[model samples]
Target: MAGAALAGLRIVVSAGPTYEDIDPVRFIGNRSSGKMGFAIAAAAARRGADVVLVAGPVALPTPDGVHRVDVRSAAQMHDAVFAQLPADIYIAAAAVADFTPRQVAPGKIKKRDGEDGLTLELVRTRDILAEVAVDPRRPRLLVGFAAETGDVETYARGKLAKKKLDLIAANRVGVEGSGFESDDNALAVYWNGGERALGPAPKTELAERLLDLVAERLRA
Candidate 1:
């Protein structure tokens, strides 16, 4: 592993769905299983980079040979990631919530007998990826993920430029057997001057190929 392509590099990654608490029990979240990010971490570790994974609430076991930091809400994830600054690469694969409850209830709010609906004020959460994009402590290679339903390349490239990422893996969700919690996925990886399509493959294999590209870029 010492002489591997990513040898001696420092890699930081974020994975899973961030939960925004509405109460002690109830929360806002998505369907991210964290397989992609975990796979990436494991792959990078095998390639000899020191890996630190900032993860959201998920049941997946920590990958062998990697450092794992567990977190719950989007804000906590942001803090955890910033704490691992000065890495060679940072991959933000988590599907973090954009907003969170403005005021969390101290306890569960019981439904009123006659109330037609409930309104909970919400506010924007920290943009972890974009935060790393601007920080002087930012990694040399920053990667992001964009899940879209249409015009995948256009949207992904937009995010690449807007978020100041070195790469973005764009995938269309709602397909028959890919995206979200699926073990299999397809990706069109976009960078500033070029792009590459990684056809549908298991999360593990996809992670290997994606990391191969990152290793190439870093060497260049």
Candidate 2:
């Protein structure tokens, strides 16, 4: 039912890590490889949805049949995601930076002989998922991803309720050989009172299973 159930739906997916520039040569970013999000985009496209993938700074090739939009900073990613509006589904899978430098140094800051340490004033970036949840052009099905190091379910459920998301996939990062930069992942997917666990398997396989659930919810 991959091609049948989701045919003609417009799906927008955000992927990779948003780089918060500290200087010309340095940035604050997570360990996301964009594999999970890219896999979801490809799976959605294969299921007959018109997919638009808004990706951050990743070296992966664009998936076939997906309209790829490349962006660097969290601000640019925010703008790009909003521009692809009025879609049927929005999957916020990107590892977006929660905070950014208050100001980017025009040039690289050099170490002084007597300086022991340096500090940066950080500011909160716009919460893309929260914004989309309240947008007038919000998709029918809005999904969010949580990469947590502790109490994954607690945090994921809190985010689900706070952001008013339809579904959230929580994964444990910092575990060797899975999540983040890994090609495989295990997701604890939660939606309201319902939840399901999907795979300690390949991202591609997990993606297809996730979309199947999405399609099921869309129909109900």
Candidate 3:
């Protein structure tokens, strides 16, 4: 990190939660704060990597020396990521919505009297990570993130294989002081046959550690 460890590398990172709109004023989203991906971009740029961040709707400022493309929905993020790709590394840290409303109402959905509940038909959003894994322009090191409430490693490993990713960082989401909207996080990183535990520390430190692992993987 003190030198240009990632020099000459092109990296793409995605962060934050995709908002799947239900109506003009309502949407389905998650708790991701975009801190982790931004930190990664910052650290990578500091290490002399050309970084492009495809970010979701988050209030955080763009990291210095990093190019950013802001997006609101999952589909836009997918397009933005691919546009910047053929990168040396791709880190998918965004918590994209699994489902979106099949049809979006053009106007604000109004509550009707005596209608206590409303139902919405939803459809699966494109699996951006899975698509990236199979893309001809896929990066050399494809990394993903899994935020889970239970069986973290088990789920993370499953996703790694399912998405054919080179590495994955998994963390528990329901815990206090870590994961989603918190400044700190802990990650268990897994590859084909190896894994490492990192943090319970600040996200900035975690990002540096994560990049260190990425550099080591690139060397191998």
Off by over 4 Å in 2: none
Name the regions of candidate 1 deviating beyond 4 angstroms: 1-3
Evaluation by TM-score, superior candidate among 1 and 2: 2
**TM-scores for candidates 1 onward, in order:** 0.97, 0.98, 0.98
True-structure lDDT of candidate 1 = 0.92
Candidate 1 Cα deviation (angstroms), residue 44: 0.6
Ranking by TM-score: 2, 3, 1
lDDT of 2 by residue, 1-220 (tens): 7457888999999999999999999999989999999999999888788999999999999999999999999999999999999999999999999999999999998999999999999999999999999999999999999999999999999999999999999999999878999999999999998999999999999999999889888887
**Which residue segments of model 3 deviate by more than 4 Å?**
1-3
* TM-score of candidate 3 on Cα atoms, chains taken together: 0.98
- What number of clashing residue pairs does each candidate have, in the order they appear? 0, 0, 0
For model 1, residues 1-220, the per-residue Cα lDDT tens digits are: 2228788889998999999999998999998999999999999888888999999998999998899999999889999999999898999999999999999999998999999999999999989899999999989999999999999999999999999999999999989789998999999999989999996999999999999898777776
Record all residue pairs in model 1 with backbone atoms less than 3 Å apart, i.e. clashing.
Answer: none
Q: Best-fitting candidate, measured by lDDT?
A: 2
| Model 3 root-mean-square deviation | 1.1
